[model samples]
Each structure stands twice: as C-alpha cells, then as structure tokens.
Target chain A: MKYSWYRLDNSAIMYQMVLTPRAQSLFRMGVKLKSPVVPSALKCAVDKAFLRHPFFKSELKRGFFRPYLDENKLPFIIEEDDGVLLKLLDFSSNNRYLLRVSYFGNRFFIDYFHGLCDGTGALEFLKTVAFYYFDALGIPFPDKNILTLSSSPSEEETEDAFTKYYRKPELGKGINSMAGGQAFHVRGKNFSSTGYGLIQANVSTSALLDAAHRLNCSVTVFLTALILASVAEAHVKGVPKHNLTAFVPINLRKRFPSKTLGNFTVFAKIIIPKDCPLDFESLVPVVKKLLEEQLGEREVILKLGFTSLMSKMPLFKFMPLFIKGFISRIGRTLSTPKQTFILSNMGKIDIGENEVIDEFLFNLNCNKKTPDNVGVLSYGDKTLISFTRKIVSTEIERIFCKKLASLCGEVKVISNFREECNAL
Target chain B: MRCKNCNVEIACKSSVCPLCHKPLVSDGEVPFPTPATKKILMGKFSLAYLVIAVIANIVCITLNFVLTPKILWCVPVLVSFIYVYYFVSVTVLAKRGFHKRILGQALILTAIFAAIKLAIGGNHWIFISWLPAVYLVSDLLMLIFIFKKKNEASKYIATLLLLCIFGAIPCISAYVFDLSVKLPSIIATSVSAAIFIICLIVCRKTIIHELKKVFNL
Candidate 1:
C-alpha cells in the first residue's frame, strides 16, 4: 500500500539536524478555559482534530539524504497534563507523533516539535482542537473564522512556502550586511533536570500597545528593546561588556502571502552594541531601525532565497544524512554565540469573544547556550509575556517585569517554580 | 494579589513572588500546575550499581592474586561483572527502543565472548561455534520482530539489513585469519545469504521502499 509522505521543509532540516536528546526543539501554545476539561470530550475532540489535519498525522523519519515525514497510523492518544511546561516528547512513548496534546484542569496544551511545525502552524492546530473540544462540550463557539473540524484539509497548507517564494538572486551578489560578531551570552546555572522555569506575566493588550505606540515602535520591537536593556542592566555590572543581540522571528506569511502551515519564518537579528545606550527609551529607535533594515522586503526575500538555495546546493543535496547532521550541529554551535536570546511574539490570537475561554498561553523552550527565551501571545485584552528559561537566576526576568510594570501600570505574574521557591 | 518588592501582581497563589521571592499581599489562583518530579532516582541507582561492580571486581582480583597467582579465574569474573553492569544499565534501564536494547545486548555479548576466547588463548570454538550461533539467533530475532510488527516493518528492516552485514563479518574474519574450522563459517554465511535473498524476494517492494527512504535515492 502506498503511504503519504513529505520532504522536510527548508527550515525544518536545520531543526532535525541539531536535534539531540538534551536539546529538544520544542515549544508550547495552550489555552485555559473557564471550566475544568472533560477527558472524554478532549479525547473525542482530539480524534476529530487529528483527522482534520492530515499533515500533523506524520512522524519524522531519517532518510538517506535528509529527514522526511512519514505517515503514522498509530492511534492518537490525548494525555493528561503532567504540569511540565515544555516536556520532552519521546517519540517511542508518544507513538511516534511529533506533537503532543494534554490537558490539566481548565487548560489544554499542544507541545510541538519544531521539526513538525512552527508556532503559527501549531496555533492553527491548537485552535482547531479547542474548537472541536468546545463542540464536544456542547458549547457554542463564537469564532467562525478559525479553522474547525468541518474545514477540509488543503494541499496548499502543506506546501513549502520557502521554496515557493524563492527568487534567485543575481550571480555573485550576496547580502550587503551581516550580523556582526559574538553577542553577549547569558550566564546562569542550568536546571537540575530537563525542564524550564516558566514565568508568565499577564498584562492588558491595550496597555502594552499604548506603551509601544508611545515609543513609536511595534510591540515586538518595544519588547525586544526592553529585554536588551534588561539584560544589559542585570549582567553588565559583573560580566565583561559585549554587544547584545535578540533574535526576533518574523512570520513570513504576512509578507509572502502563503497559507502553508510548514516552517516559513525568518528571523531579524536586532543588535545593540556594548557602547549603545542601555535605557529603554533610547534603545527603541536603535532596535526599530535595525529591525527595519533586516525586515525589508528585499532583504527577507534574499534570505529566503539563500536559505532555500543552500539546501538545494549539489554538495548539501548529495551529502549523507549523518555527515549533514554533524555539519549542521557544528554550524548551530558556532552560530549560537552570535545571539544573546530569542524573543518570539506570536502576535494576537483572535478566538473571538468566547466566554468559556479565560486566556491563551505561549511558552518557548530555551537551549543550553541561550538559557532564557521569551514567548508572547495576546488574547481578549490579556497579553501573556512568558519567560521560559533553563537557568535558576530570575534577575533578568525581575528587571524586565519591573520595567514592564512601570509602562503597563500592572503586570500579573504566574510561575511553575512556586513549589521550589516555597521549599527554599 | 500584588508583590510590593517586585511591583507586580502575583497572579499565582504562591505565598511568595516568583521573581523577588517576597510575600504577596493577597491570594489568587495558580495558573500553572506544579511539575511532576523527574525520575532522578534511576540515575542514582545506576551509579550505585557501578560502585558495587567496581568494588566486587577489585576484591575478586585481590583474592585471585592472594590465593592462586598461577590461575586467572578473575578474568571471567571481571567479564561477568562488566556484562552485568552493561545489561542492567543499557539493556534493562535505558530509555531506548526495545529492539535497540536487544540488538545492542546481542552485539556486546558476542564481542565479550570473543574477547574472552582470545584472552584465554583457547581453541577456535568461538569462531566455529559461538560466533555462528549468536549470528543465527540475532538474525532469527530480527526476522521475528519484522514479522510480528509488520505494519512497522520500515522501522525494523534497516536493522535487519544491518544484521545481515554483521552476519557476514564472522565469516569474512574466519577466512582472513585462516581458521581451520571453516565449515561452520561457510554454513553461517550461506544461511545469512539465503535469508537475505528470501527477504528480498518476499518483501521486495518493502525492502526497496525502505532503502529509498533510508538512502533518499
């Protein structure tokens, strides 16, 4: 019998190459409902949602040249949430599914392996699952705009957007400017085990927007500037001064206009030199300007083209899988020191004015090199800015919260480290 | 609900601020549940096994030296200890696939037995009898696994193919070293080749598909 399979996307190849047992490229996006979750309803809803999205019913398989997604026929099992933020997804234990869906109390989370899909794609899946869940609960869903179980899977949803928009550049022409030398690395003792210390700061969406508007910048740029300044203030006194850079992932769908749910995002490296002003107000323009330079249409297209082109190079195409994986792992390690932290703003998730849902949560997994990362998602007046770190020190998060409180008036914080702190 | 030290609202119901670790003024609901503690005891248990194995090996060696310096009974004891530790840690306790653990155990045991034979300067029983028998058992186990989990044949076929390659190694080594007992090696190589041929004929499409997926050719 024939089976459905797909070539790993241009960006997913990198994720697969650098994937280790320790460094699981995982991230979570979840929703907290007003009432406790029903296990039977969630299981039924997940089954329906799994059938709806055929693209997500596959597993990553190692190929001779590169990894590919093979159709997985294993029964989809919805697990009870074990209270871990971004827990490792053991493929053998998870029946080879790259993504996991689990519920705890009123919240249900979908932790996705980056090789399967990026955050936007995973959000679409989450919304669909949540929509089916509410349906199973016999509750009315206010949002008809989101993808539901009734929607049919489309071929375009699985297309490689990076390859689709690849415009060959002129011969011998390359990017004029590149990200400069090594950014300052964050220092802290890692967690005792493989888990993240999560701190979610809930603030009003309008308040954050108002603060960003006052600085004449977007919310992402404003937050990036704040984080850079906070890192500088928190670590500069003790450590050697170095340039601070934040990697902000920009969704390519907005500019390229593709509905592909595959990995189709590029990052804009916003660097603040060691000598630059460390205050929030002065750093905004620098961030805004640098963001603009990297996010330009021509620059993004060039990057997309080059990335896709590199994957298609004869040397890369013919290299054996193990060799390619080794090379990519080395490449990732070498390039990791060039960035300080990752700041991913998932933008606003409009689930409509659904009375049953309380708020949305977005959490990112940090690696050993960059121990602290941020994930932001806004839903229904509440914008949750989450700090997921592998380290113990909260000095950077403390400074960031204090600065954010001064701007947003009030910031409500929640964390998974309450037990640890209480014991201490 | 608010933490004065951090100047932020304590959304969770913890007694102290998550950031500043200071007392909060009022109580609130915790948004996230406490994470389940990990199984760190398994790691400590493995370490304990290692310590015991080391002490046992040291005592056995010292006793062998004191009691019978002419004899080398401690060699087998050391090998047995090493195999026990490996079996407990990697085969029994490691978080890996069932097939991987079994295959790994088979390979390690074969190497250990071969090393013992060489260390003792024994006869060619290792190559003529022991090696062939181990290869046959491993090949049969892989075949059974493939047939039992036919739906997941793709996952097992690559390993089976690897076993076929390993099966040929003993035959080739026996010839290269010119061991007098060549009939067993010939019989083992023939059996392996015949099994491979049968697999190729019976599941030709699957074998080809698995190779294409594996090689991406």
Candidate 2:
C-alpha cells in the first residue's frame, strides 16, 4: 500500500505549475550511434541503467498541496521513434511515466518532462543507457567514469540541491530587483499543426572554440551573441526595436557541488538594450559583461535562495494544489512576454572515449509565446546547434546559419523540413 | 555537399538547402533518414461525418422554417446531433481510459435527459428515477473497474471517488428544489455513502495512503 514519493524541487515547482496541454515543458537528448540500434539490446540497456538511476522510474502525481513524483511500477518500454520532435507526452497513455525512450535507425532518443530533471541530469541517464547499450553488445567502453550498473546510487543523487544549498539571504539585500521591462518577442505565423520543426547545424567544435577564443568569450557567450545578432538582422524592417533578452539556463552543479539528479538549474536573463550595438562584434562584450554579472556565485545563489524562499512561504505552501497550479500558470504567462528567446547550452557531453557514438543531439521544445528556442551540445569534434521552432518563418535560422558559416567556414545543416524546402 | 546561397554544407541528401532553399552543388550521405509520414486515422471518416451532420441540420432547419416556423421543431434535432457527435468523439472513438469514457457518457446522457425533461415541462421523473439511476449505474461501473483491476486499484480510486461525489448531487437537488419524491434520491445518496464508508473500513490503509499522497504539502 505504501509507495515512495518525492517532493518536487523549487525549480520543478515552476515547471509543474505551468504544465498544460499546449505548453508541456519537455526537452530531448539523443545520440547517433555508428550502427543501427538493436531493440532487444536497447531494452536490456534500459533495464540495466534503471537500477543505478531508479529515480527516473517515476510518475508525476498530483498532491493536495503540490505535485510529487510517485514510484511507477509499470514496465519502462522503449518505443520506436516517431520522428516528431518534442511531441507532448500523454501521461495516461504512457503508463504515467514522465520520461520516454525511443529509437530510430542508429539514433536513440530520450524525451523527458522537465519536472523529472534538468538537461545535465537527463544527459547522465542517457550516457548511462548508452554505456549499457554498448555493454549489452559485448563491446567495451574506453572510459570508466560513467555510472555503471555495478555501482549503487547515492543518497545525494536524489537530494533537492536548491534546498540543500539554499542560504538565508541578508535582510532586504538579496531580493531580485531586476527590471521587469518586456523584451523584443519574435513574431511570425505559427505552423498550422501543433508540432515543432527542428533545424540542426553541425559545426566543427575546434573551429567554434577558436572563434569564441578570438572573441575573448566562452563558446556559450559567443553563441549567445551570434544568436542575438541574428535576431537583430532578421528583425522586420521599419519596426521599433525593443531590447532583446535571452533566457540562459545555468547548471548549478558546477557552481555549488551537489549530485542532484533532479531540477538544479537557474536562469540568467541576458538583456541587450535596443540602443546598444546589435552587430555580432559589439554584442560579444555586452553579452559577456551581462553574463558575468548574472552568473556570479553570489548572484546565482541569491536568485536560488529567493525562489526557495517564495516556494516555502506559508501562504503558498498551504495553498491547495489546484489553486497553486492556477496561479503558477498565470505567472508563467505574464512572465513569458518579458523574454525574447531561450538559449540552453548543455556544454561538453562526454559519455566515454568509445567510437560508437557519432554525435549528440539536444533540443528544447518551443511554446506559444516563445516560439523559437535553441539547444546547444558539443560532442567530440562536432558542436550541434539545434533550433526548435513552432513558427513557419526560417528567417532567423537562415541568418544564423549564414553567419555561422561565415565564422566557422563550413556548417552542415540538417532539417526535417526538406520536403517543405523543395516546394519552396 | 555545399549550398552556395546559404554558404553552408548540406548534411542531408536533399536537393536544396533547408534554410535558403537554394540547390546544392554536390551529393552527400544523409545523416537523418526521412521521417515516416504520419497516418491520420479516422481523419477522412470524421470529415465525412461532419459534412453529413452539417447538411442534415441545414435541411431540417429549412424544413422547420417553411413548414412550422413558430414551433421550432429543429431545435431537438440540433441538440441530438450535437450529442451524437460528442458521444462518438469522446466516448466511442477517443483514446481515453474506460473509466473516463463511462463517466463522460453518463454525465452527458444525464444532462441531455434532464434538459429534455425540463423542455417537456416535467421534473418528477428526473429527480425520482433518471438522475438517481444514472449516478448509481456510474458508481457501480466504477466499482466493477476497481475490482477488475485490483492490483492497480490505486489508478481507479480517483474515478471512484469522483462518482461518489456525483452520487450526492441527486440528493442535494431533491432537497434544494423541494421535490415530493425523495425516496429514490435518498436511496442513491445512502448507497454512495455506504460505498464510501465500506472502502474506508476495508482498505483503510490504502485509502489513507492515497489521500496522503494526494494531499501532502
């Protein structure tokens, strides 16, 4: 009769609050292996990986006060990939599991509901599954750093890092005081249907790194600046330019040491004023300065602490779950208009030194308000920048690839809209 | 392999660049296979049904206007058409759980029956027979499902609880509207109350655990 359940983390609360049929906060991480995926082997790999990371074998349950994760006893089945990017998961049809694993051709994909974990956590699970997949095939992996089936999961792995690292803020000093001004929203006609269109640009990692180094900024900053410049160029002529803000998610595990496999990330709102230079060269330093200021240890902690404090307030804590969910949806809707786009960089992903995987792919789902979102992931020599959009216009994507081609010399483009392109 | 207009290498085997739509200069291996075309099951059938329903309604409305405009005989036909469409889509064809389908059909039927009774200027059978009968049937069906899927009883408990809540409505309406025939409403409420009490007594631990999981702060 008793089942294990977990209280959602502070960051996860926001995700649960805004969860709707239209705005399902879902993201995907996948890898393209050298050989075609064997279904039986992949199934064995998933079963093996589930032992080490049993927290992912859970479902979202609506609690009286909030939503919690309940242990799901249903079999974790690996479905065939449907090719639609970031399709919404129907919990009832999916046996109430919050995550889905599917394979197509040589690629294996894991699409996770954002309430389950952040990108870093999902990447760990994906790597572990891949490691076991190769192991099931009787192939040896070169690197042993991956969490294997042999090791037991640690208690720290399931801890709510936001609560663990939350420090009481000094009186009246640590409250978030950022301006609530609205950012320039990307406007265009949406796709007639309800799925996302993916456009991935594969560039040489070394070339991108060198370009970023030349700009005296990290790859994330460099790419963020480039995207800002692209958005500026694609801005319709004769319209008043508003400030562009990029919602960049920063992984907290790097700053504060915790092995939380739940949601343990905060966002940095990097705003580029309209009057500021919109050129790529000029945007680099501006983005760098803004990122540095917002990404500081103190600032990040303060933001996390403020969120923790808000979630724990007696008023919100005791409120009924349905009312809380209603308020959360409203808050998300009101807050979305203040941002232009999202840029989530998962940084370098290293599963092992094996030659099995050809590349890694990461993608973020777009919402009605923010119809354009980008996900970046680097593996081996290839850095993939995936643009997931709900809109039909590819002007932003076109300008982005053109600029990257001019910078990196050659950018390989792959898309699901090839048929649409032929018609055009 | 290269697209001159976009100045980027074409990764897939498509003839034109996905971004700029310019023809590529060289052929290359496709990294991603073409996505399988999605099959829209029942799309054509649904469209045909909708077209037929629209035409039927239009003909009926025109006939009513010409033959007996003051009576408005087409209204019930329109309501029946709407009810049939909802019943087919949600209860019959929709990929929903059995519990949801049963509850949905029960609620919609009850509403339609009540509306018809009210339209005919009668309210006695609705309170004494129709409403209680619908609630009792829904509650029994939910209980059967819970028992059939005993191992996964937790999954169906919420629906059962919802049916019990609906069971109270007939009794409440009887009192609120001061209906003369109170026996059927009383019987429905008592049955629902007994079921609720029995569930608490028999599966006390499981019910408490479920409640805790649902209401945890």
Candidate 3:
C-alpha cells in the first residue's frame, strides 16, 4: 500500500545486456552460496521490514525498458505508480530474498546490480541490513562497522556536480549505443569461478602493503601481477600466447560521494604484457606500475570521453549491440593489455576486531558469480583471495597464490576447490 | 595502445619496443574479433515493431470489415498511420522537433480527401470517416510538440494524444464500417483519459525520451 521513497523520485539507471550461457550459469551457481538462515530473530526482523522497502518488494515488469531509466543525472526517487508498483510487488513477491539476504545466513548481503550501486554503496547497504536485522531481533548490536570520513584534504568522495546531474544518460538509453573509438580499458574475457578454487593468504594490512611496496608495487598491482605469473607458470607454460588480462575494480569513492554506494567502481583491465617473462619474480614490478596508471582518475576521464562521444553519435544509436560485440572481439584479438581476470583487492578491512567476535569475516559476495575470471582479495585479520574461473584453468590460481605467498615468504598450495566454500 | 615502460606516449601495435620495446601487455594477445550488439538489437527491435503493428492493424482491419464494409479501407490507413507515427515521431523528436516528413504526409492525405470530397461533394463513400482523420492528426501533433523531450511535458501531450485516439477509434471504426454508430462526446474524452492512465502506468520509469539521455543519445 505504501513505498517510502518512491514519493520522491531520485532518478536511477538500469543497464541490461545479454551474458553468455556461461555468464548466466555462474549466477545460478552463486545462488548456491546461501549462507545459513541468519540469526532467527534477525531473519524475522529483516523479513518483516523488507516488505516495507519498495526495492525488495519490487518485481520485474514489461515495458519499453526505458522509463525506469533515471536520466536526471543523479539517483533520484520516482513517484511510485499504483499499477507499476503493484505489478513489481507481484513479481518481487515470488523472489523477495533476491533483493535482501541474511548475509552468510549469519552475514548480511544485499545483491544489488552493479550499474545501480558501487562497492561504496554496496558496503553501506551491507552494514545497514546487518543493523536492521539486529535491531529487529531486539539484539544488543554494537555500532555498525561502517567507515565515515570527516572532511579532509586527501580524502574526497565523488562530489562531482557534473556527474551528479550527469546520469550517464546514454546508459539510460535502451541498450542503444555501446562502443566506438578507443574506449580506454584493458579488454578482458570474464572467467567465472564455477570450477575454480580460492587461493588466499592472510597478511597483516601493514605487511601486505609493505610487501607490495617492497616489490615496488601497489596492493592491486602486486596481487594482479602475482596472479598473472601464477596463471602463466601453472597453465600457460611454454605457450606463446597467454590470453591473460587483469580486471581491476576501480573504487569511485574518492571522486564519488562518501555515502554513494552503487556500481561506481569502473572495471579497468591490466593485461600482462604478452611477451614478458612468465616467472612471478619478473612480473610483479611491471604489473605494479600498470595497476597504478589504469585506476588513475585521468584514465577514467579519458575513457569516459570516448564512450560519451560514441553514445552521442546518431549513427551509433542502433550500434551498441554490434559495437559492443565487435569491440569485445577485437578486444580478444587486438586487446593486448587485455583483461583476463579481475583482481578485487578490498584493501585491508580494519573494523577493529578488538570489539568484534572471533574477528570479522569479510567476503565479497560478488552479488552473483562473475563470468569473468576473478580473484577477490580481501584482508581482514586474514587475507583471503577467492578465485573463480569458468573460462580459465585453476592451476593459474595456484601459481598466483604461490606468487602472493612468495611476496611474504612462500605459500602452500591447497586444491579441491569448492564453489560454495569461503575461507577466512 | 600504450608503452609498457613509461606508458606515457603513444606506441605502435607490435612485439618489440618502438621507443622502448618494453612490451604491449607482456602477455601475448591475439586480437580476435567477435559479433556486435547493434546487429542483434536492430534485428530484435525491428521484429518487435513489425509484429506489434501487424497484429494491431489486423485487429483494426477485421473489426472494420465486420462492422461496416463501406468504410473498411479507412481502418487500415488509420491504424497503420498510428503505428508508423509512434517510432517515427519518437525518433525524429529525438533529433529535432516534429516537422517536414510528418506534416507532409498529413497534408498529402488531407488534399487527396479534399479533392475527393469536392468531386463527389460530401456524400460519396460515407464521409464521416474524415472527421476522425482530422481529429487524429491535429491531436497527435499537439501531443508530440508540447513536450520538450523527457519532461513531464511530453507525458501530458502523450496523455492527450492517447485520449484523443481512444475516442476516435470507436467512431472511426463505426464510420468506416458504414454502420450507423452513435457515441457521446464524453466517449472520446473517457477514452483519452484511459490512455493517460495507461501511459502513466506503462511508461513509469522507462519513458523513451528519458532513455535517450541515459545512453548519451
């Protein structure tokens, strides 16, 4: 009967495109990671309150997929329509849990689509949902472990007035205009984690960064270069061509808003230079530098410029599908420095475990299983690098882990990787 | 695309260094090509448009023939006109406002009818269908031009046009079928009202004009 924020519409954007069967399959596999049923009280509270939020209660509807597009330049709310809301509610009713989850059954997870939210926003919702469950259960919950920054010199959130009014309007278009010109990015073929095992190593945040610095690299570069070397050594061996790419998650918090958590993290790929020495020792330095440049704000600006221009061209209105495919293909062939796998290093997650129980468990539920090969690098009290590969061989993961381990000292390889497993 | 060492300047697509034969992306890439998305969507949308228009036209044709054989031809023309106009107007308005091609068609149709009406003078072929034609054309234009692309302005225009058409449908059908049909002026009004309601409902989050903006169109 009522939707809280819909009365005031802050525009939103939704991008839809087809994924390969492999991509679609990964999502289904992802659903298998149904954490335990969450705390009973917390679960009950969330279930009750979830019904109040329109996002959870909403369902997919049929229309020209255009209206839902928030071209107002910012995420604004829309006045909910009785008919549309009713239809969405009806659709969502069948799968309410899709929007909200009892994280880990014990953990909290909100599986929002990336185009709609970034890691910053995702983490915000994650913390909010956890507290919602706790308060609902009438349980004694401590302060939510969310980080908020006071106004500072080095710390900046995406306060871009331009993007605030800039709703990536082209994204709002109905799958129209997708590619053209040097859309600066390290092109990559997504490798799902369906059949891969995770290779993680826990290093003190200080130690981790120190090791990276010792290797003269950043956290992202060290991890990616190591993974690339592992992959090259374990799988690509003597092969002339190693279809290797590193899909790095670029956090937009600095340029975005402190509270903004949506899919603001643009995917910047760093393809290991094709002819480089495959040994882990040789690769780290090269990758360290690439990751730094790839995520630079200027790089994003340059890439966006080309993509924006392409979208504005009238001739490309009906050209996205063709363009995206052609680009992706060319990306495969000519895309050097291509993206092979993504290295998501959620740099040291320090929520001060001194107050938490049995230390904090931080695992990135990529919302859904990614079709792209991925290594989720998170360092809490423990550094766990979970690997997923539907497209590549798991041996690469082994070598990658070994390389990471070698950075500190040496890593011990463990196999028999399971899809639904999580190591802290 | 870039250098491996400094990575600052432009570089050639090769294995060795141009300025500093460092490497493109250490890992060798083949540059394989794949099919594109535009080809897929064009095929998909064109088919959707064709199917929807054909079915709608067929329904109109059947209804016209069954109700009144005398004004049957008008059914196809009017219905087809509506279908064609939808995407066309949406597309043209996206680039520029409605003009030229859109209005020219109306004038051509109007003149042909005027010539026919003068020659046969009012009574030939049951001229009542002409009333709906005038109502449809005038209303559609006003509805389209009033909105300045993606604002609430277009919705009202859309609402108005939809309502006008809702009213014209029944009357036009009756006239083309050559049947003596009596409908209150309120009928036209209520029809338009229903269309407005539907537009509000269907186009809720995804209005086309707004969509163009999101895709940078």
Please provide TM-scores, in order, for all candidate models, with all chains considered together: 0.89, 0.86, 0.51
- Give the local distance difference test score of model 2: 0.81
**Scored by Cα lDDT, where does model 3 land?**
0.41
Off by over 4 Å in 1: A1-3, A169-179, A188-190, A237-240, A273-275, A418-424, B36-39, B42-73, B84-102, B173-181
lDDT of 1 by residue, A1-424 (tens): 2347777888998888888766778999888989998989988888888777878989898898889888888787888876666878887688889888888888888899998889999998888888888889899986455776556778788888888888875434545444456778889777766567888889999999999999889999999999988888888774446678898998999998888878999888887866777888889999999999989987788778776875667898888889989987887766755678999999988767778989888899887778889999998899999999878888899999999999989998888882383222
Q: For candidate 2 chain A, which ten residues in a row score worst on lDDT?
A: A415-424
Separate DockQ for every predicted complex: 0.51, 0.43, 0.03
Winner on TM-score (1 vs 2): 1
TM-score of chain B of each: 0.78, 0.74, 0.30
Q: What is the lDDT of residue A104 in candidate 2?
A: 84
What's the distance in Å from true for residue A59, model 2? 2.4
lDDT of each: 0.81, 0.81, 0.41
* Residues forming the 10-long window of minimal summed lDDT in candidate 3 chain B: B30-39
How do the candidates rank by TM-score, highest first?
1, 2, 3
- lDDT tens readout by residue for model 3, B1-217: 4433422222112343322234454232211111121222545555776787778777777886788766546543554455465545554433433533343444445445544444434353433445345445544554455433434543344345444554454365454545454343234445445545555555566455534443334
CAPRI band for model 2: acceptable
- DockQ-based CAPRI category assigned to the predicted complex of candidate 3: incorrect
- Candidates 2 and 3 compared by TM-score, better number: 2
